[model samples]
Target: MRILIAQINPVVGNLKENKRKILEGIHAARENGCSLAVFPELALTGYPPEDILLLPQFIDEVKKELKEIAGATQGIAAIVGLPRANAKPFGKPLLNSAAVLFEGKILGFQDKTLLPSYDVFDEMRYFDRAEERRVFLLFGKKIAITICEDIWQHAALSKDVSYPLDPVAEYANQNIDLLINLSASPFSQMKAERRIHVVQKAAKTLKVPALLCNQVGGQDSLIFDGYSVVCDAGGRLVRLGNGFQEDYMVWDSEVKADELVAAFDKTEETYKALILGLKDYFGKQGFKKAVIGLSGGIDSALVACIAVEALGKENVLGVSMPSRYSSEGSVKDAVDLAEALGIELRHVPIEEPFQSFLDILSPEFKGKEPDVTEENIQARVRGVILMALSNKLGHIVLSTGNKSELAMGYSTLYGDLCGGLSVINDLTKRQVYQISRWINRERDIIPVSSLEKAPSAELRPNQKDSDSLPDYEIIDTVLEAYVHDHQSPDLIAKNHGYPKELVCDLIRRIHRSEYKRRQSPPGLRVTDRAFSIGRRFPIVQGWV
Candidate 1:
């Protein structure tokens, strides 16, 4: 028997487009004479419809689409994921479900047993837990179908953490011939290895061929890298599909066993993931062009470079929004950087807007001198101009704030935070510099002056970031410890050789600014935890 895995990228809520893709995948698999084909989790409505799942009309539309797909499934057996309605009182009436279709009929269905609740997921808020597991016979083999999180329970990371029962294990005991898992698993650095290890271990223990079909493409903050694979009973990889792309791979029982041991290209995998993420976010958000505020800083330079790489330079507009606070060398550097990157450079002086805001606000102050408030006004004024241009030209503005500034509340809300997408919001200040250097090393697109210039927001007269915040090296260390490591203030201070009070103060600012991040735009996920949806903190809360 031939089994095909169709790892595909589907647009969320675009029923017509997603259906077209699924039909194409099914046709491709059928042409190869495959008996069964598997698609990723929520393949019908895309990975996450988010709150769109709440609309009754949307659910009805999904059911209609599912029926349409079922009618098209003649002669070929397929398993596809979608949301199913469970009309019970006093709870969310939906289940993350998979349906088996064959010969123009719905054979059976299974609900996702595990609903991930942490880190960019609130599945518990939307879906009820499935109560049972079952296996279906097809092509003389019993197949156990599971959703993304369902199979993950067997390899759950924490032993102390109580979780739902392992559905795959129960099915394994039921003498299944194949274990099929559908997923919309998002990308994180080195996460692919963990996934492969889990699947391999499961295949070895269960003594059955395991197939994983993952979704590809970016959906808001999540980027699903589709590195789907098939592993034999001995835990040997049999077939590997492309990562960061829509691909269909067929595994036959007759092919030589040694041919399946080929490895995936790691560097190309990560590069494609980043590119696909940037492309889909820009494309799906209905932005024909992207306007980035290029300050000749490493962060902005890196973001501009990535923007150009993702959306051609013709679609990318670079603006050097300079102020009196901006150094002359930095102004030259911004112009030079734009020329080197082949992006259009426009100089917009914020001196007029800065003076206008200061004049309006000065009368209300009773002899109080200028401070960060005045600095923030400059940032906000520049923000207003970018937004205005964005509105005038129908371009989406991209903010360049990195994770370090975001973590310490160093960024001004409604100022630098005004953008349709925050490209590097997940990267720390240090990683921003590192990626900048890497981009320059790989391709000499970024100007050297951008790397050499002192980091500054240029929001005030003779302002430097070091004046208010610690140097990036020190600040990023403190940030990583407190944010990603989730270390206590005392532990962070002891580990990083900083005063406990200082660490405590940094954590306090991060908590206080939860309201700001909550309103910020979706950003790319280059880290394990990013600011947007992944990291959740109560906006109205106090430190104990």
Candidate 2:
């Protein structure tokens, strides 16, 4: 039997378009004379439907789409993932399922056995754990199917006791010939290698062929990198699919397994993940154009370049929103950078809006002297103009704040924080500078002045980031220890050679800004623990 793994990127909630892709895959598999083809989990409605899963109408739409796909599977047998619902007695409705379709008929169904509820996943909120294991017979082979988290039960260890169930081990004892797992796993650096090791270990121990299919594309902050693989009963890889793209590969059951082909190089994989994330996030949302406030700083310059790369130069609009406090060199640098990227540049001075806001609020601010409040007003004015252009032109605004600023509460809530997406919110200030340098290494897309100039908000007459926060090098180290390493303030201070008081203040700011982050837009998650979805903190709590 020839089995095909269709590693595809489906737009979340775009039922019609997603169905088209699924059909296209089926056609390709049939042309290759494959008996069975498998797609990623939640292929119909996309993965992590989130609150959309709560709507009864949305669930109905998913079921309708599944039927349409089932009808298209005339000669080929396929397994597709979707949400299944049934009426509950004196409780919430049942919403869990997967479909096994062959010759336009539903052969069987498997509800996901495990519901993950931690760190950017809330599957338990909408789905109940399936009580039974499902096994299906196809092409003279007994096959067992499991969802993403189901196979990871062995790796999930508790401090005191072992897990009661091992899905792969149980299926191995049943004389199953093939183990197929579908996943919607998100991307982190080095995650592809870890996934391969796990699958190989499982195949070697079980002595059964294993097929792994994963979803690709960006959904909000999460970007799924599809590196699908097929391993033989001897734990040797037969074929590996492409990473960061939509690909389909067929593995013939008669062919012997071979050595594993190494996945994409590290930098190449990271770059592709960013590009795919940016492309699909905008494409799937029906956005054809994007707008950004180009401040002639490294952050905005890098974002503008990435936007031009993701969306064409014609679709990207770069705006220079200058204020009374803005430096002449910065404006020149912004124009130069836009020209370098061959993107259109527009100048929208914020002096009028800034003064108008001050005039309107002067009465309420009677005796209080101007401070960061004035600075925030300038930033908010720029935000308003960018948002106006975005609304008028039907373009999504991209916020350019990096993780370092976000961690220090150095950004204004509705000012720099206003946008449909935050591209580099997971990247620290140091990483931003490094990536910017990399962008300019081969070609000069970003102007050198932008990199050489001292980083500033340009919100006040002589505002520099150092006025409110420590230098980025020091601040980023503190943040990495606390946020990514989960170190306490005292521990971070001792380890990083920082003053205890400063470390404490930094942690306090991060904790206090939880509310602001909760309201911020979704960003691309490059790190293991990014803000917004992955990191959760209480807004009304006193615990440090």
Candidate 3:
């Protein structure tokens, strides 16, 4: 049997568009002489519809679109993920379900067995668990279908959660010919490799070919990397779809295919993921132009490069807002970088606004010496200038704060943190340098001076980041252990041979900055633990 894996990008809550895409996939399947076409989880209404699933009228519309899609499946069979209303009326209002359509009507539904509730997932709040496992006999082939989290039970990716019942185990000894999964899994650093292990394990256990169709495109902070995969019955990969974009692959069970290698390396994969995320964020939101503050720093330079790549250089505006404390070389670097990218650079001096603020606050601080407050005023002045341009022009601002700065509370709230979206808020300082170097491997698109300079805010004279926080290497290592890995500060200190006092102090700063992050713009999530979406902390907690 030939099966079509349709990896599609669906806008959340756009029912008509999603239905059109599903019908398009179904027609393609029939035209290609394929027996079955599979779509990603929640393909109809889009993944994680969130509160949209709570609307009764939304569910009614979904039923309407689903039936129209079912009508188009005359010559082919299709498995589509959607929200199905619960008839029992005792548990939740809807079931995270997959509709199996064949001929001209609904064949059956395989409800999702496991509903993840941790991290970025809150399916337990909306979806009810499946009542039973099912195996369908189609075209003389017995196929067992599972949702995204159903197959994930085998891998046990999370230590805090475990399911008592295994969905794949229930399909064992059934002599199934194929196992198919519908997934809308989000992208992380190594999540794609981990997903392969899960699929391979399932294929080996069932002794049948396994296939997964995943969602593509970005929705808010989440970027879905659609590397839909297929493995043989012996647990070996035979087909791999495209990453960070929509793709379709037809797999023939009788024919043997060559194994495919991973498409991009770690840094390149991350670069592409950010590009896709930024592109979809603007594309889906009807945003046509972007404006970024170019401070001649690595973080801002990287964000500018990514903005130019996502929204064309013509669509990106780089503004250099230099203050009195800003060095001439830093300003020149910003101009050179903009010239290299072929984008319009606007020079807006913040000295006027900074002096105005200082004059106004002079009486309020008559006896007080110029301190961090004066430095913060410079940042807020720049923030106001950027926001003004953003208001007058139709371009959305892209913030340049990286994860490391945001972690240590080094950023000024309502100042450096001002933007419509945070492009690199999940990437650490080390990652920022790494991706910038990768961008300049062939040529120096980003200025070499910007890459090699000491990291600074430039709000004060000779204000190096090292004066306030640890070295970038040390800060990144400590953050990887404390923030990402959830390791204790003492353990991190012991493992890295760092001072225990310094490690504890850094963790405290992270804890104290919860309120600032809460007000920051939503950033693209390239890592598993991002500040705004996945990781939640109490602003008033005393755990530290």
Worst 10 residues of 3 by lDDT: 257-266
lDDT of 1: 0.82
Q: What tens-digit string does per-residue lDDT give for candidate 2 at 65-120?
A: 88888898898899988887854553335555668999998897887777777767
**Which residue ranges in model 1 land beyond 4 Å of their true spot?**
87-91, 158-161, 259-274
Best by lDDT: 3
TM-score, prediction 1: 0.94
Candidate 2 clashing pairs?
none
In model 1, state the lDDT of residue 463.
Answer: 74
* lDDT by candidate, in order shown: 0.82, 0.83, 0.91
Predicted structure with the largest TM-score when compared to the true one: 3
Superposed by TM-score, candidate 1 places the C-alpha of residue 495 at a distance from the truth, in angstroms, of 3.2
CA deviation > 4 Å runs, candidate 3: none
lDDT (tens digit, per residue) of candidate 3 on 163-225: 998999999988889999999999988788888888989998888999989999999999999
Give the higher-lDDT candidate: 1 or 2: 2
| Tens-digit per-residue lDDT, 207-271, candidate 1 | 98888999999998888988897888888887777877789989876455663554544444544
